[model samples]
Structures are given as structure tokens and as C-alpha cells.
Target: MSEEKPQRKIIHVDMDAFYASVEQLDNPELRGKPVAVGGSETRGVVSAASYEARKFGVRSALSGVLAKKYCPDLIFVRPRFDRYKEVSNKIRQIFHEFTDLVEPLSLDEAYLDVTQNKKGNPSASLIAKEIRERILAETGLTASAGISVNKFVAKIASDVNKPNGQKTIGPDEVESFLEQLPIKKFYGVGKVTTERMYQLGIFTGADLKAQSLEFLEKHFGKSGTYYYYAVRGIHNSEVKPERTTKSVAAEHTFNENLSSEIYMQEQLQAIAEQLAKRLKRYELAGKTVTLKIKYSDFTLQTRSKTLPYFISDKGLILETATELLYQERMKDSVRLLGISLSNLNNEERKTVVVQLRFEF
Candidate 1:
């Protein structure tokens, strides 16, 4: 007789409006008021909007001027990425207390594999609860968790009861749960894909499942296979720990755009310093340095150079970033300055030298 495969326990934790919530937690004046963390309302974009602002149709990636139009009383706060990174590190530390298989999707969300965990508890739901509670107790912030057998279901389940709540989908309930799910709710089904599905008479998971694999593949290609299996609760992706830093970067959008070379250099220096600190903290060095610039009119450009050797020094970063900054003439007044280190020297395995003794 064939043996049954082991079912893995996974959890997806997402902070509720993380950036905006952090702002509200730190500043009492911002609580209960429509708030956005981004640049000025004059000529920039919204990075995150609080729930209060969301009610007025303000959302991240929306232009600040339009966000203000949506919410007349919207208060905009500049983003403090350093503080956000600090909080993210705290959250990751908490995850490690339960399990080492923590995969961070961004600063605000992560997937955890707790099938074999330090706590020796079999209940993933209980672990998630404890993690959320600890995050609130330690950082004074709330997070929502979804416990399931796989990452796909867990991620979708996390959104079912958002804003400081959780949901669990057991192995037995997978099919029933997917059947009634709206097509729009399916992962990877964006607005355009959802509309296409609607045009094809596929409104729900049930509708999608009705099509044969050949039909789906014929119409949707590779993504169709994804939807075919995903709706059946057959996602098998694993959570991978961030064993190495991928890129070190820092960027700042100015309150007022500056045109002078001196002002640009000042901003680049600060960005380079921030990048240097991040690289040093991770014990990483890179051969490629990239400089990202955004003009007052919102046009963007990037210049990069690959050094002969990997360097993590602040002086090298500042010098390279400064050189990139002046490599081209100013197209317009600059509103944003950014520096990033790529081609990192990560994932290298250390070799151990051993001495052999021979007895005659």
C-alpha cells in the first residue's frame, strides 16, 4: 500500500495597513483621522493610506493630488522607511521564536512554515494567535493571520477577515471554500483577467473548474494551469527564508524639488549613507551601484556602474553614487534621490579547512 504524504502547516501574516497603522500608533493626533504616508500633495504619490482615507477611495499608488481630491481632510505624512525597517525586523524576530521557516513578502507581510516548530505545538492556528498577540504586545501593532495547508490558501484566507482578524481553512474544507469564491478573489486574477473570465461565463471558482484542462490551457496558457490547480486547493509552493539580502537601497523624495547640483549631492550623500548602513548590517557588499532620480514632472531615470570589486564602504558608495548623479545633465528639477547596491556577494558557502594526521 502507498503511504500518504505529510500535510504541511503554513501561516500567512499581514499587518493591517502597516505603514499607516504605525504612523497612527506613534502619533496620537493621527488616530481616527484620514492619514496617508507619502510625499507632498503637490506633486508626488501616496505610498499608503489609512483605513479612514481608504473609505474615501484614497489608496497607495494614487497621486497625492488625486488622493486629496478623494478625501478633502486627508493628512499626508512623509514615510520613515528606517523606522518601518526596524519594525519589520522586530516582527521577523517574533516569527523566528515560533519557526525558522519565515518568508517575508515585504516589510508588512510574511509566510511561515510551522509544520515542525520550536514550540512543539501541532496547532498552526494557535501559533498564529500567539504571534499576533505578541506583535501587539511588543510593538503595539495588530496583524492578521491565515492558517492553511499551503501558501496559496493561507494568503487568500488572510484577507477574508482583514484589519486585525484571522481565518483558518482545514484540509477537509478546501474544495467547498473554493467553489463559491468569486473569480475576482482568486489570486493572479486581476481586473483584466476577471473581466475576461466574466466574458467567458466564468464568474466563480465553480465556473472556472467546469472548464477542462485543455480548454483552460488553450485559452489562458500558463496562467490557466495555475488557476486550474489553485482553485482545486492544490498549490504546493514552499516558504523560503531570506537567507541573504537581495539588494540594499535607500531613496528620498524631496518636499520641494531642487535643481542645483549641490542640493542633489546632499540628498545623494544621505541616501548613500543609509544604503551603506544597510549593507554593513547584512555583511553584504556589491559590485553594482545604481542611482535613481525622479524629476519634478515625475519622469524617472537611473544610472548604474559596476565596480571591479564588491564594496560596502560608505565612502565608496558616496563616491560612486555622486559620480552617477553627475553623469548626465539635469533634465528637470529633481524631486527624488535614491541609491541601491546590487549584484550582491550573497549565497556564498564558506569552506572549512581541516588538518589530517597520519599515524605510522
Candidate 2:
């Protein structure tokens, strides 16, 4: 007889238009309007757009100028990342009540492994429901959830019922569910990959499954092997808790391009200060400092240096960033300047080790 496979319960939770929803909740007047959270319409890009704004073809990452052209009445509000982080902490607290196996993807999304939970609850769906209700009650915001046996399925399922909803995929239904899914709907399959898949006559999960593993590997490289097993509902990747923060960064886009090195240094100082505060808040320090510059002609350049010791002091970060800035020859007038710190020191890093066992 075959050994029984271990079953895992995973849940993916995503806040609905998190930033725009927060804006609406705080100010009653902004509710039900086409609102975008970003910089001024004169420059910069839309960071997030409300569902109403999306109706007019406005979306996150769309340039602010184009967003205005799409919806002239679109209200652009500056992003409040600190406020969003505060709310994210509250949501995380709720997840902890059910499971300690929580992995935050961003300020608005997370993955929780509840196969074994604090409440000793085996029903992942019920836990997802309770979580959503608690989030709505505590934050006055709606979150959608997806519950499944693994991270990949759960992450995809969460989006099926977006904007204050939830979906579940049972173990028995996994293969069938994937077979009917469109190629573009697969997680990690970007526009370029989709175009390639379409050209190869692979438009759905079923079509992808029809190809031999050897054929997939020959054509798509390592990812082809992933698709072969994924289509058949085989995924062994564990749900990692507390995803690492590889870097911390802060950036600013100016209305007018800056040509003078002195003025650029001033902007870099402010950005370094912001980065230092973020590092301090997270109790993290780094040995590397990187400077990024975007010129008016849309050209981008970056320079980085690694220090001997990890330092999170504002003055030290500014000094290092300025040095890097000056080292690079000016390509063109700058429109944006930023700084980032890497090589973080995370004290709570988790590692798992496996050993072979033989049954007598």
C-alpha cells in the first residue's frame, strides 16, 4: 500500500484596493469617488486606484498624467505608507490568533499555513472567514481570502473572488480546477510568458498539461518542469514564515529635473534620513548603501558601495550615499533620487533541516 501524503492547509489573504479603501474609510467625502493614491498629476505615477477609478481604466503604476486623461475627475491623493503599515500590523495580529505560520507578501497581502493552528481548528475555510470578519470589524476594511492545500493554489484562489470575498479549492478538485484555468491566470506567468505560451498553442492549463515534461523543459527551461507538475496539482514548496526584507529604500520624484550636484545632495540627504528611520524602526542595519538616479530623459543609473561594518545611522548613510552619488558622472539632469540599504541583519531567521529515516 502507498503511504498517505501529508495534507497542508494554506490561506492567502489580500486587502481590497488597500490604500484607496483606507482613504475612503478615513474621509467620508472620498467614498464612492474615483480616487487614486499617488503623487501630483503633473508628475509621478499612480500607486493605487480605487475600484471606481479602475472603471475609467485607471490603475496602479499608471502615470498620474495619463490617469488624469482617463478620468478628469480622478482625485489624486498622496500615498501614506506609514498609515498603511499601521493597518497592516493590525491585520497581522489577527492572523497570529489562528496560526504562527504567517508570511507577509506586502502591506496588503499575506499567506498563512494553518494545517496545524493555535486554535486547533482543522477547517481552513472557517479560519479564513473569522479572519476576514475580524479585519472588517477592526480596520473598517474588507479583505479577500483563498484557502487550499498549498501556497500556489491558495494564492491563485484568493483572486477569484476579489474585493471582500473568499474561495476554496479542495484536494480532490485541484487537478480539475487547474485544467480549466486560463494560461494568463497562472501565478508567476507574466505578459511575456503568456505571449510565448499562446504562440506555442498553450492557452489553458489543460493545454499546458498535454505537453511532455521533456518538451516543456527543452522549450521553457526550468520553469517548464514547474508547469508540468503544477498542472497536475503537485507542489511541495513550504509556506515560509516572516519573509526576509532584502533591502529598505526611499525615493522621491521631483517636479522639475535637477542639474546641480549640490541640490541633488540635498535631496539624497532627505532620502537617506527616511531610509535610516525605516531601518531603525525594523531594528535592521546594513553594510551596503546604493544610490539610484533617474534623469529627465528617462535614463536610470545606480551606484553602490559596501562598508566594513553595518551602520544604520542617518549621518553615516547620508555620507555613504553622497559619496556614491559624486562617484558617478552625471549622464543627464536628474528627475528622481533614491537610496537603499541591503545586507540586513534579521535575528529571527528560520531554517529547517531534513534527515533521512528508514522504517523496519
- Alpha-carbon lDDT, every model: 0.87, 0.88
Question: What would the per-residue lDDT of candidate 2 be over residues 1-360, giving only the tens digit for each residue?
Answer: 122323778899999999999999999999999999995678779999999999999998899899999999999998887899899999999999987888999999999988877886668899899999999999999999998877888989999999899999988878899999999999988899999999999999999999999989998999998888888777767767857899999999897899999999999888988898899777899999999899998888889999999999999999999899889579889999999999877655784523122110
Runs in model 2 deviating more than 4 A are: 1-6, 250-274, 277-283, 291-303, 313-315, 325-338, 351-360
Count of clashes, each model? 0, 0
Q: How many backbone clashes does candidate 2 have?
A: 0
Best by lDDT, which number? 2
Model 1 compared with the native: what TM-score?
Answer: 0.75
Model 2 residue 16 lDDT score: 97
Stretches of candidate 1 exceeding 4 Å from the true structure:
1-6, 243-285, 288-307, 311-341, 348-360
Q: Write the per-residue lDDT of candidate 1 for residues 35-110, one digit (tens) a residue.
A: 9999567877999999999999999989889999889999999998778989999999999999888888889999
- TM-scores for all candidates: the values are 0.75, 0.84
In terms of lDDT, model 1 sits at 0.87
